[model samples]
Target: MVDLLRKSEAFISQLSLVAIVDDQIVGYILFSKIYIVDDQGNRTPSIALAPVAVLPQFQKQGIGTQLIERGLSDARVLNFKSAVVLGHPTYYPKFGFVKAEKWSIKAPFDVPSEAFMAIELVENTLQGIAGTVEYPKEFQEVS
Candidate 1:
């Protein structure tokens, strides 16, 4: 999946971040372009946070947290309106992600509501946005 996303046309290198310690990568996170499409077929651009990981030796440290924080900040600077993540219910909220359902957003696949979350980069960016998140074909290729 990582390779596919990186190679896909939709991949934006600027949105991929890594944590390096002593010249070795200790953590990584990728925020890729996605969309929120309403029932009427209106599409709202967004991002998807995926493949966030820290090396086993680096787990429980703050490396993962740093990666997430920095990545989201960069996304906001890039003018991304929002972001979604299918991640741990407890872990992601520290970054302000709420259940996407709060805005009537849904995931394309079955996932616990708590595990699928979204956040607005700009205040109220998702106020009127609602729909299933449309991930890139690279995701489907891996599934």
Candidate 2:
């Protein structure tokens, strides 16, 4: 998935981040551009936090949490309105993610509501936003 995004989404590189220790990559996270398409076909821009990973040796060491915190901080600096993620219902909430359904936002595929979450980078950025998230074609290819 990272390879696919690298090949197709130019800006993805800017949002792609990694954790390094002892001159080795230990973790990674990517924040890719996605959209929320409303009934009238209006597409509101957003980010998708996906494909986050930490080497087995790095697990339980806070590397994933650091990656997520840094990624979200970068996205906010980029002026992104919000971000969506299909992740642990318990884990993501630590970073302020709540069920997308709270704002009428949804995933393109069926997912447990608690697992599909969204976070507002800018205060109230998603207040009135409502639609189904449209991930890039690369995601479809993998799925």
lDDT of candidate 2?
0.91
lDDT of 1 by residue, 1-143 (tens): 87999998768799899999999998999988898999999999999999899999999999999999999999988999899999999999999999999999999999999999999999999997889899999998886
The number of the candidate with the highest lDDT is 1
Best TM-score among the predictions, by candidate number = 1
Question: For every model in order, what is the number of clashing pairs?
Answer: 0, 0
Error of 2 at 86 (Å): 0.1
How well does model 1 score by local distance difference test? 0.93
* Per-model lDDT: 0.93, 0.91
Model 2 scores worst on lDDT over the 10 consecutive residues at 6-15
For candidate 2, the per-residue lDDT at 54 reads: 93
lDDT string for model 2 (1-143, tens) is: 77888887624676899999999999999988999999889999998998899999889999999999999988888888899999999999999999999999999999999999999999998888899998988888886
- Alpha-carbon RMSD to native, per candidate: 0.9, 1.1
